[model samples]
Target chain A: MKLLKEKVMAEGIVLGEQVLKVDSFLNHQMDPMLMKEVGSEFVRRFAGEGITKVLTIESSGIAPAIMTALELGVPMIFARKNKSLTLKEDIYVESVYSFTKRETNEITVSKKFLNADDRVLIIDDFLANGEAAFGLARIVEQVGASVVGIGIVIEKSFQPGSKLLKEAGYRVDSLVRIASLENGTVTFVEGE
Target chain B: MKLLKEKVMAEGIVLGEQVLKVDSFLNHQMDPMLMKEVGSEFVRRFAGEGITKVLTIESSGIAPAIMTALELGVPMIFARKNKSLTLKEDIYVESVYSFTKRETNEITVSKKFLNADDRVLIIDDFLANGEAAFGLARIVEQVGASVVGIGIVIEKSFQPGSKLLKEAGYRVDSLVRIASLENGTVTFVEGE
Candidate 1:
């Protein structure tokens, strides 16, 4: 978390008090070493939860989720943003609206991968309005599987995502919590 | 490679003469332990290439590419399939036609991530028509970065992807090469 916070402070670009661009090492360009450590930290936090699978949305979430799944010795499943040609049916689908892109895209996970007996850990790169997290949780619920916890790399605490997930009774563990990104500077939540 | 071949033989579903569904391990539903081995294998194959970066397209390619980057101690970059609000301008864009989906997508990578000094290794989940691989290569070339080699998890050797890449004079290292998928059977290229 310290390393992630430091990386954010060093390289994260704040745009107009809302967007944090971590393209240098988090999303667009990834730091695998950092991802490994983030995975280990997620494992350390959710070790005793009996997680059978690690679930995440595609693209950015794949790196951290795959690393966590590797550490925990479980399979990682990424929910596709769009329906693919091969993945035709028997899937749990949820509609998520991205505040950044201002568009709603349906995220899907094949029913073949998740089941009622499985315990899942949801991981993602960033948590803002919690649409993506809730959408993932809905897919998990549709399959009757239990969401043990949610692991986030960067949580915009100024936003409603972290609070909403906690209110919904899901354990949300974020590596770094951003208190504010105002005036072209980042502020981390103290003692988190 | 032996282990990968075994996995393909065990879990890979032959959809037809053309499609090989490796969703259980390689792409959709990922095995982290297997991916770790895959990353290490890629590193072993392209060890001395001085690869400064690992590049791939979004969604399917992130896992293997990130793992390779982890092993190589470099950064991994996944080209976006569509334009996003955050990543707007100053990007290297290439149009890739997905034969499976029957559509063309414009993939973009920020110019800030890649440059002329980079030695890149392109990694992907599958190699069929080579559209995705060539698209990524063009982006690399746009920045004047040299593509040292391409690492593929599964190569449909019966298709033109391997031949086309080889013809283009790029080193193609595939973990498992499939000879054919005729009559609902998966056959591997002998001695590969």
Candidate 2:
């Protein structure tokens, strides 16, 4: 978590009061080394839980989800954004409202992947609005599966998503919680 | 490679004539252990190729790309399908036609992630028409980088993508190359 916070402070760019572009390493172009640390940290936090699968959204979350799955020795299922032709399975569906993009999109997962037997760990790159994480959790529930824990690499405490998840009675563990990002400096929350 | 082949024969569902969905292990729901074999196999195939980066398209390809990058000890950059706010810096954009979807979509990657000095290894989940693979290759070429090799988990030999890639002079290696899927049985090419 310290390594992530340090990398974020050193390289993260704040475009506006809301936008934090970390394409250099976090999302667009991934850093496998940092992701390994992220995986270890997530495992350290949620290793006690019996996680059967790692669920994540497509695009950004796939990188960290794969790392976590590798570390946890479990399978990772990435929900596709669009109704792509390659995947024809309509196993489960959930509607998520993205506060960052200011758009709502339907995220889907094949039912063949997750079921009631699965104890899932929802992983995401960032937890701001928490819509993506919620969407993944929704899919898990649809399959009658239990969400053991939600592992987030970075959580923007300024938003209400984290509180929303916690209010839902789910154990949400974030590596680095952004207390504030004023004056181009990041303040990380020290405790859960 | 035997493990991959066996997994494919066991789980791979051939849809109609050309579609082979391996999402059970390779793409949608990723089998992390099998992906390790894939990454290691790729490393052995292109060990001394001086691959500085591993490139692929988003969604399904990210898992394998991460595996290869971890094995190669390099960075991994994934091309985005649509315009997104998260992507920053200069980008190498290309128009890709999805044969399955019967539509065209533009893929973009931040230019800062890849450059002329990079020796890129293109990795993907499936190769039917090879459009996505070629799209990544084009991005590498536009930045004056060299593509060391192109790795495909499953290659449909009936499709013309592999032919096109071979004609274009790329060292294309597929773990399981299907000669045909007649009557629902997959025939893998020998000495592939």
Name the best candidate (by lDDT). Answer: 1
Q: lDDT tens string, model 2, A50-130? A: 888999998788888888898899998899776667675666878998887778888989888887999999999999988
Minimal lDDT window, size 10, model 1 chain A: A83-92
Fnat of candidates, each listed: 0.92, 0.86
Candidate 2, superposed: residue stretches over 4 Å from native? A190-192
What does candidate 1's lDDT look like per residue over B1-192, in tens digits? 999999998999889899999899977999999998999999999988999999999888899889889988999999999988889999999999999999999999999999899999999999999999999999999898899999999999999998999999999999999999999999889996
Question: Which residue pairs show backbone clashes in model 2?
Answer: A91-A111, B90-B111
The best candidate in terms of DockQ: 1
Residues A25-75, model 1: lDDT tens digits: 988999999999999999999988999999999889999999999999999
- CA lDDT of A41 in candidate 1? 99
User: Model 2 Cα displacement at B113 (Å)?
Assistant: 1.3
DockQ of each: 0.91, 0.75
- Estimate the overall C-alpha local distance difference test score of candidate 1: 0.94
Q: List chain A TM-scores, every candidate, in order.
A: 0.99, 0.95
